[model samples]
Target: MREIVDFDNLKMYINGEWVTAQSEKTYSVINPSTGKVVANVPNGGRNETKQAIDAADQAFKSWSKLTAVERAKYLMRLYALMHQYKDQLAEIMSLEMGKPFTEAKGEVDFAASYFEWFAEEGRRIYGETIPSNSPNKRLMVIRQPVGVVAAITPWNFPLAMMTRKVGAALAAGCTAIVKPASQSPISAIAFGRLVELAGIPNGVISVITGSSGPISDEIFENPIVKKVTFTGSTEVGKLLVTKSAHQLKKLSLELGGHAPFIVFEDADLEAAATGAIASKYRNTGQTCVCANRIYVHQSVIEEFSEILVKKVKELKVGNSIDPTVQVGPLVNREGLLKVEEQVKDALDKGARILCGGKRVGGELTEGLFYEPTVLGDVTPTMLITYQETFGPVAPIIPFESEEEVIQQANGTEYGLASYFYTQNISRAVRVAEALEFGIMGINDSIPTVAQAPFGGIKESGQGREGGHQGLDDYLEYKFISLGI
Candidate 1:
């Protein structure tokens, strides 16, 4: 008999049972690296989503009643269990999401840290007694769990995004129904399995995956789902907000980004060049905060262009499972075409392609692989400048002054993350503050940790995830007064 992956029988997990959808439709999960059919997830629709919400509602009644210490114990157990399966989860994630094994492992580790952090945070949820103005009157303010939550996570950083929401939900003693992205449902389903093994009661955490339209509508319409946390594109985020507003549902959104990576003349050239590769090309440039636009100071523009373009060419693009591969294919056919359209439009609009601007073919063509492309002489009016190039293509532009670069960088409406490279502390601090992004990094390209909140500004997003900020989304506060 051939061996079968338990999750391959991918189905909805509701009230602790791994079951098929009532709709009986199925969606294929494609391995972006090779464009191979990896697995099939249930085509969950409104009926199945309602089932998940019902499970969560039932779970919340008891879950919310648990004492803080009791809830903390469950999170601690979940954390320890995640550590045990960390490597396995990483491998599954890499296969499903087409991220390199190394990066996928890091994501798994990062996801686990959220569980650990929130597990501790559960014990520290604070309440206060307040002095009342009226005589013999007492006032108290307490933070309570926001009831059943609907947590919808995106494909990128599949595990971490799920953990970011679920961790805070669990920590706050709220039951949740998770809708992991269709492209990467395996990890989320596996997480449900692990939660079961960790001794979590049935219905406390339900995992469901399906088409975006019906499933998402079901979640928003359900009265039992008190809170909804979402991570994805800005357009979708707005639609969700509109739907949730009807019932006054709680929301937390971490949406799209067109992050700017600024390279000043005072920056250490070598470090900036090195960091550019990691910032722009890691995971083949699918990151929400990956340096979409690189603004280089004119003084070092030529030198930076030469070094950066050379490094971009040297990166190996292939299967994510291969340890040698530094870049992988775009996530799907839609993603590949989207990036290709942007690249072609930019090229047609007088942008000079300095290196690699075409798609891979022959044996490589079987996959969604595109070369790491670099463009120069790009004007701000071009589509590539205004829209997000979430693929491996990056456009480099030169600026003459700090004020001009900052103005250009902040020109875009999206403001999730930005990067600066300068050795001078005063200039770095000044530039970092001036950039109109929620998150800024100086001399670094690494994404923020669990201790720091992550989100965007303006069109980028509203609300936050990770750190104590994540806990903020899962709670609601009320004040009460007593007179004797």
Candidate 2:
């Protein structure tokens, strides 16, 4: 079969030019499906990160000066280019991140939607004119770009995460320096190429791939960076908060989530089952918002478990290159090990495995593939109950009352996303309001969209990523009072 992407030509994008690391060093990006090298990306460090930051800083002077409508045109062109090369971008994401090609294609469209949404949203950035308290006085509030922004993205959904941040930043007239996760930098590099083709000015956007520590260090220390947006683990998010404290930089963190999927007896069993499968196993459950704990009404636990297991069993697991495959390998061995450890802990704590419980063997043994798992008799004490199991394992816990389940769901420190299925409109409203999570789905499995606000409360991090609120973090609101 012909290769979809030219892996050899990939390089770091800085100042509108493709370049290699100053150290002449590179790192191999491994394909999780086969444990083989996919491509060697530039191993940038502090020096390259600084260069990218400087470029963005310089670009900000012009980029931020442009009218919001003028910036929207560049984003519109890039959005068109993304659709034009969607197949190649999807292929690269699948090879590097080990997500199914179909899903990757969906992600490409999803990523591009941000550019499309923000392109129009930018034009509507409106300032307020407040009534003056005294005669001959005028009061007004206007929003302006926050200047150079540093976006640190994650491996899972690499393209979508970067676009969610960069799109809003650029739309708000901020230049961005992105440090994509080393494991999946190719997608960002490819997007940078599209940015150049869109006729965006030099230094408006830069994609640097390399060591996370040094890159992040440079971002935190640089005074040129006025805002920092990140999507990753809670531990890393906390560290960024600490680092940014010294400089008081604007920050938007979309951190770890331990979402709860509650299934009430009143819910449609078939619909609940399908939603559970989609929520718990999408991207092999590596997503930050993937349902971690499932709380089923005790009366319907058995029926729900059977239906969920049947649907999970129907999912085909294989290499991402396979068009028919629904489930793909974990991003790396560490992710696989965490899944194994969580399963073992649940089993040891007396949870029963209904369908899948162990790693897949045979031809798939070389890859980081785990069977889509379902565990019954799960309790709060079990490791899988509270921890964010970043894998395709569904642990079912039974609850007797709405009050009891609500308490259990809100027990975790992370409150990023939650879902509950109910036929009763009153119960849906009650549960939705009670859930402490930032984002909630009353009956829907996939609730995220380019037009909605996406973020979390509590330890799941702060600030919004989508909607008009998405542009808020990238902008600074100024109030002017003048006496005539």
Candidate 3:
């Protein structure tokens, strides 16, 4: 692939300008597929983070005053630019994040859809006239931007996660300072270049690359930052909540998920197996909502396992740059270790390895790669039962009844997403309602879209990310009362 943007020359974006960290410190961005350094990014600290915040605070005074329609135009431009540079962005993400090129291209489209969706949604931020107790008195409610926003995005789905949060915030008329994960800051910098080309005003959007602790500390302590949006582990989400507590900053967290994929006996076995593979192994199972535990009906466990293992064995695992590869390397050694540990734990506890259960050697690439794993006879006593195994491993447990499956599925503290395959309409409705998750897919594996509300309940974290509800967390409501 030819290089469009100069990744080696990238810099942090602040106040609508390309700049480097004041500390002059830098860190290398490693390509997970080859374990090679792609580029060096500025390792910003508190000073750089504070400067970005100040810039955003200054810009908010004017940015928040623009009409929703006017603001939508900028997002429209961004949406267009994202499409114009779609291939390049995907290439950047694939090279830096180690997802297959095909999957990365799909993610580029998914990320652009957010901007397109919000461009129209911004114009619909309507206020309401309320009924008054007295004829002479008028009551009204209006929503406005929630000032400066701090978005802390994750490494997985780097572009999509940034657009999901920043698109809504900017559409709602808020200036933003983004702190992208250090592992994948190049993608954010590339987006920043687009933001500049899109003619978004200086200070309206800033991308700061740095250590998480210093950036987070500055964000929490800075009073100018009115709201904080984050997507990461549940442990980090809790820490952010605690940090922002004293400041009373508005928070929208999309945290860790231990999603359950259930297969009913009456469902189509082939379709169920296909859906399970799609949901469990996408992006090498690095996604937060990837199905961690699978529950299959006792009657169909044997048949389902056969189909699932066959499909999994056929998955192509190699470097992400290959167009035909489906399963790519883990982002780092840490992730690979986690996957190995989980698989070992399940095997030690009597779970049978249905298909694969080992690390891949460097015949493909000398990077962190683990085989797409499937474990049968998984019980609750295994570590994979409760922990968020963020890897390419599927642990299948047999369930005798619908009630038994639901109980076991909802047993986890994390409830971001859940899926089930059922042809019976009544059973579908009953189970969908009973599942303790913010997002559910009935006979569908991938349910996330730009037009629908995406969030979680229980320990998965709070607030919504997409749809009309996405703009809510970035806005503040004010009620007006007038008497003649």
Weakest 10 consecutive residues of candidate 3 by summed lDDT: 1-10
Which 10 consecutive positions of candidate 2 have the poorest summed lDDT? 1-10
**Candidate 2 deviation (Cα RMSD):** 1.4
Lowest summed lDDT window (length 10), candidate 1: 1-10
Per residue, candidate 1 scores C-alpha lDDT tens digits across 1-484 of 2111375577677888988888687888888877788888888888888887888888888998998788888887877777777777877877888888878878877888888888887888898999789889999999999899988998888888998889889989899989999889988888888878878888999988888888888888788888899999988888988999999999888888888888988888888988889989988899899998999988898999999999888998878887778888888888889999988888888888889998987767778888999999887878878888779998998899989989999998898999989888899878877888999889998868887889889888888888787788889998989888
Ranking by lDDT: 2, 3, 1
Give the residue spans of candidate 1 off by over 4 A.
Answer: 1-8
Report the C-alpha displacement of residue 148, candidate 3, in angstroms: 0.3
lDDT of 3 at 22: 87
lDDT of 2 by residue, 411-479 (tens): 999999999999999999899999999999888989999999999999999999989889999888999
Off by over 4 Å in 3: 1-4
Per-residue lDDT tens digits of candidate 3, residues 1-484? 3344586677899998888888788999898888899899998989988899999999999999998888889998988888888888887888888988999989989999999999889999999999999999999999999999999999999999999999999999999999999888988999998899889999999999989988999999999999999999999999989999998999999999999999999999999999999999999999989899899999999999999999999999998889999999899889889889988888898999988899888575488888999999999999998999878999999999999999999998998999999899999999999999999999999999999999999999999999999999999999999998
Stretches of candidate 2 off by over 4 Å are: 1-5
**How do the predictions measure up, each by TM-score?**
0.96, 0.98, 0.98
